[model samples]
Target: MARTGTRSTIGRTPPELWPSGGTLVSTDLLDDGSVDAIAVPLVPAVEGEHGAQPGEGAADVSALYGIDLAEIADRVGLTGASGESYVLQLPRAVGSAVQLPWQALPPRVVLLGLGARSAADLRHAGAALARASRGLGRVLTTAGVQGSQSASQAAQAARAFAEGYLLAAYRPPTSATGPAPAPSAELVLLGRDGTRVTAALDAARTAAAATWLVRDLTTTPSSTKTPAWLADQAKRLAARRGLETQVLTPRELSAQGFGGILAVGAGSASTPRLVVVRYTPTNASGRHVVLVGKGITFDTGGISIKPRESMVTMKTDMAGAAVALATVLAAADSGLAHAVTAVLPLAENHFGASSYRPGDVLRVYGGTTVEVANTDAEGRLVLADALAWADATLEPDVLVDVATLTGAAAVGLGKQRGALFGTDDALVAALERAGEAVGEPLWRLPLVEDYADAVRSDVADLRHVPADAGLGAGAITAALFLREFVGSRRWAHLDIAGPARATSDRHEITEGATGFGARLLLQYLADLR
Candidate 1:
């Protein structure tokens, strides 16, 4: 049985109560009782442009609310700047109730600036509006500023906005403070074309919910989400999605010669587990894609313990597994035509008398011997076994592994993007495009063939870490080590250490577990379809 209950519907709008597209009524046609807030876009003012005439949307909003728009702008110091927000209380004229046959307008009017009119900018604006409208019931967003954009462009912008809003509203409880209050805000988009806007909203909602699931799993305490617990969750998810699921026990792993995983997991009381989930369509195209994740529930660095501070968020070491699980679920939900398989190598690396140490040679699956240079580099060890197993058993056409494998990646890419290393140029480009489309950007790092020499071992076929401790390219070396298990197959290694978690809330990203690779992998799978 799964230890945790079903996830809270904290960031979701109930299907029956989900906001529907409202008519694009003039501001004068809106009723005060219909909504609690109205959000309008405000672009930055041009150098020579008169501040009196802010924009068409602002003018319409000012006239509808019967307020002096210029005076409000001046009072609020709104120079039509981006990322700037100001809320104005609308005056309720006595005995001026209009019997308009349109959606009612909220009492509060929000002025949001459009910094660059880019998708990222739209997402940020949407998140800010969501945050501001927390206690408010419903918000009506007018897309007048984006009306001139093409239908597809408009839909993209709407999707970004919805994503931002839904993601911002998420707040998972950390203590016995009971559950956080459920978000009551309903997002209704007003636009020239209601059908297209509705479609965009639905799509964005699905994608955002998938990301929320990833966040929930990754943020759960490691003690509550052990290797077996994660496998059980995978099994349940696979059953619900009509996907094939297989979980291998520690005894089974040893029988199959997954020495890398067994050795890394020996120190932990909870044995390791390998979960394989497959989504195969009946008329599937032969484009088989395999996703491998490093599911280290908690990393204590075994005998080679990390600094006390470094282990603070060690529970997030399994972010890669969470991404893979969410991606597979999303792919199955979308009913794509391509066959997909997700291999999750789940384990907890702790220090104990039974712990595997340096100088240990692990015979990974597919018979590759890896010398353990550092016990702390356990993510790649487990992943190596999974990658080799998937390659040998699944023989997938494309293989991609996502892992929080190195801090060097964070140092190289910062927290803004993930490090992507791949054998195939086309695969790398596809992943890059997919990541960019979803705002989970990936920067390509070279898999310099010469770096392979760094892992060449004297006692074994390879070393898990670089031979020289001072050598740079830790991220690149980790990827190169994983490449050995893939043989000549097309593969991509995503070092998601940087973007998987955030130090602070920014844009659409929350403070914990950013769900970084879920959307990117989903997009990639969609393209394959």
Candidate 2:
């Protein structure tokens, strides 16, 4: 069929021509650069074993075939493909003694043990394989044991893993320094008969990669990716994916009475923008999903300016927008048979004479007036208008808003786990399940309706933040503020303050944008039906 075993993988270079760490590919063997066939041994390592040794049944086949072979006979397991020169898997993590030949198998293969098979681990493994594949300039593929008890779960894992790996490996043309290199391709899930794990993995991976395309555009620098710029990005994506994109500028927003967005963007040079992206498949069924995201390009805290120390990183305030766009893209890529809409209210919070005062009471899109208690608390204001719009426009079956809304959320959930607040138990459960499936951790928290009274204003419909409320509940109060705008829609809020940006790690990725919800949202949509 599709070239079974490691021997068939000798010279494929869909992603790269060579592997990283100075490994040579079989494609570079001729005097003037020609391809040739090379033989490598395939050995399986079982648990509690040291190296491969010729087994009893293998003696007859070996004698009949007369194949040159080497043995590491220890019980390290391999998921797929048996061939000459294949780098076999050892059940446990063990160091390699010799330089691995690139052409022996795919350019890169990650042997993820059974213990570390979570979606996040798979993502990390994918990232590792992508780096190796990109360096080698060859196509990268992964093979692993089908461990899940459920066939669908196993298939989902394989596909999700392939998608994450391929997307992580992508290097955009804009990010390239000199004469750009070719893009790398991805493959995964080998050898599971009647299993269609490959098909599922391919579909999921395609969807995940598409989400990354949108996320990358949103997570880029503020100088290059302003509100208008991001709207353009959404427009381009919608067009490419056969979706609908609507961009509203400052004038249109003001005409439509989106006072919250107008107020937040008044102080910045860049005008506020509201981008609504919609995806509707031909035979859409089931519940409609709505996503709202905060799009603050940079948060200077208005008149309540932030400290000069590390304020530069505030550009990532729009991380919520990135997640929103990525989620929509993921749905489209996964071919989810549902109606999805992503609404992003984009702005830059800064200090200027035209900025709204602390006592300003502005009417939102839904005629709800909010007193601006603290200008630093600006993300909720912008999101308030968009959330109102999402509810009024779609009246969706379920609405979920994602934001890097509060530092308190970061403190509450750390950099990896996100806090989920919602009125809908079913939607929350689905999101949590999707998070687990994709390795993006999400935890549920109480809305504590009592806190709603805390945000009530003496004059306006509500106060943007509760002055009486302690700083302990900043994240909760923020979610509560947006809750007022959600109306009767089944809604959830995800605060991803900590995980959106990163510091550093030992991985090939240094630290800038984490590219979070793209994969998670993709898988969520895929599993919806």
Candidate 3:
């Protein structure tokens, strides 16, 4: 069943909510018209007031509650407020249902963990709350967060909170069904210093919503999210956002001589397309950042069939496309400093008589030829053409291509970290830093020159798959294939096969596609600007 909830906004509350050090203010007990919950500042003065006698040091919440930590979790979530001194760690975050009992309180007690919580941890916790309260119609009427007096830092936290909630709760309605569910509540900042923070958060929320809009379209099943249909979506978003847009059909690609994309998509009845979206800010003077996404809406392994289990999540093969489109939207909404360009190479890999076979050499966009060793390795083929086109035509300051390209990435990093490989160290460093700031973990993998030799074809310029069947390095080989097209352009390749889909049960996601790189790319672009 679909989960539902709401966040109510009804009262004017004090902004002095974040307590530095550790302090507590007790509310009037059981008053006739008292508020549902009160925000207590964890300041230093209250630490002594809570009871710290000489020779008898105070205890933490676990000891003060006089119960096991697990039991407390069972009762009221993870909020710890039993007259104990919690070492306030900057940006730390934790939650407890005890802070607000869902059944007893007017609304559930949603505690905001600030001290020990990293930005990513807070985002993770916020997403969890969205799921836990799904369909319950719970609202975040009050938020208790702590930080220094810096307005930007506070604003950063507020923006993070908003992005977390917005992305975690978004669900696109299935085409067979009707519209998506309505939002449950209004998000309001809890403290006084939130005026500027609120505005920053509002900007971030707008960007996140745009991300959801694009991701939903990308994640739709291939039966529905066809190349032409995806182009329609790009056109709609462009018209709405006032960005420049163009859609090239299979015939156009063939005429333009983009044989790699055309050849891979020839077997499918859906055909193929290349979507381009451009956003130029009014006062921007910086060079453009081009985002290329591999939009294989579905992959059936072409002439080479995949196992049933491997084919189940093929709908999300376009996750990179989702991020590409979402990044452009985010850049425009945030008024980023640089001009942005997004290129989505959309196609399908299916089996039919027309399907390209093994040993067939494909001449991609930049005149590079590739030997099709495995038709299932079609993502690289499409991206090779797209990347070549981007380099030769757009000639942006930097080129970034994101794709759910290889299973080897999943085997290496699991689902929490995305693997990044590139030719430019500075560009890679910027992405790494951006990933950390947003709580989206990214790791750099080697693109050894030795690996490139493995993909070299005896008959053509390159082979779709390496010569050795059992040898891994699939991610490296995919990146190597893409490198040929990038040429000398500053480029980075993100293999999101690991993080594109959640691997296990998490606080925010319960299976299905995760909006993995939307925030990372958004923040990275904003920073570059």
Candidate 4:
């Protein structure tokens, strides 16, 4: 239950299904006219006006159809309303004797609707167009997010379009490819030539690169994503990005008293590891932000095994770690002024002879004991160890832990949003703003101090989860359980269980790992003082 009602699977999957933002934003298309489509965004008509305003490059595209866009929209009964799309097919340019190379197959001219020109609407429009252009060689979009706007405004629109396009034009690397919305080799956003707009789009592409990496890592099959594999990926990232990294082995974990992590991973032969990555820029902001991501490689609910259906998507349990690692690397890529450290406690919860059982008490990092009430609640257990370790060692100004910790989050918020909880209001608001800007919206739920007693253990300092299945507010109690690890720090918890993975394609989200936190955290870090 991380980022959605459930989590997922990956590894051995070829990444050929989607482009990884590598040379995705181009100034021009192929010289041989590989572009199969041109998407021009449309703005709705004014209250009293007759037709909608056409996006840039519309005149050039409409000429190919021998009619203006307004007439085409009217002819097709296409209203430029939000989420509306119309593809005006050019069937061999209506039997033209002399056909241009681009008009050889009557290519496509798509009109995408932008509602109120909001960032999200713009992103959705881009996503819709991308989906419509699936399986094509190339697509050039005049996103209609430019002109008559300030530099920042123009940059915002460009960023949104790029993010949306890069994100939505993806399909899982699966063998059975039956109408899963194949991605184009390249998607060029036209009319983004200014310096400010170029840099903004560049940054957004960088962020998308990070998220793509996250999705790839989380999408791998569990057998290929063991704790060692996760640590190796982290090391590879550190080596490539010049970040400081350390991978702690199981022996070291036990010596350092990471009881929770050790216990949760005991049943798995892959062992457990804690990967610490540090990014210290030269002119740092002097404010440290320590991130702790739950790295459960595959969750089988330990002794409390899940139903056969529930186990299907459990491999995405490590999505939080993938996002945390990706975000830190993106921050380093952007050269942010702040110092960021990410602690990913990697494990796999399996049911075996050594599986930590209910009624078992184990000491987590920083020497706090927890009662294992529910083995399925291993996410918070692993996160607690990392949070405690970060608070005791990193001295971060702001502490944030990310996890797909509970299904209750999806139960309350659905699959559209993530659950945000924190001890500091300002931190929460900043995060809210960042999430909103990145199109990964968050819904803040109160800490509910009264729920503190629900996680209280009769035997240990805390219980991993309430013993009663009927106990409501599972998300709140789960957050409360995590609150005990950070000591008086300005901390925030991102329970991405509601939106970490998607059940189907929606907006810019595909039917797999959503990689929700990477962009949001990157945005927040960019705005930090």
Report model 4's TM-score to 2 decimal places.
0.89
10 residues in a row with least lDDT, candidate 4: 11-20
Q: Which parts of model 1 are misplaced by more than 4 Å?
A: 1-34, 50-56, 90-105, 173-177, 181-184, 192-196
Estimate, for each residue in 381-419, the C-alpha lDDT of model 2 and write its tens digit.
999999898888887988889888898988978888888
Ranked by TM-score, the better of candidates 1 and 2 is 1
All candidates' TM-scores?
A: 0.91, 0.78, 0.80, 0.89
Q: 2 or 4, which is superior by lDDT?
A: 4
CA lDDT of every candidate:
0.80, 0.65, 0.68, 0.81
Best-fitting candidate, scored by TM-score: 1
Name the lDDT value of residue 119 in candidate 3.
63
| Cα lDDT of model 4 by residue, 162-213, tens digit | 6777787666654233344355436666665667777887787778777777
Q: What is the number of residue pairs that collide in model 2?
A: 28
Better of 3 and 4 by TM-score: 4
Q: Which ranges of candidate 4 are over 4 A from the true structure?
A: 1-34, 49-53, 93-106, 174-182, 467-469
lDDT of 3 by residue, 1-529 (tens): 2111111110111111121222211212213323232221121113534321211011222232232333323244334332221221112124552342122222233333332344655455455445433444323322235434377766766666556656666665443345545442334344424467657666667656655654566556677677776777777777877999988897789888898889889898888999999999998798799999999989999988999999998988988888898789768877788999999999988889899998899999978888999889999999999999999999789999999999998899989899999999999999999888876679999888988888889899988789897778888888887888897999999999988886554643435677678778877877774
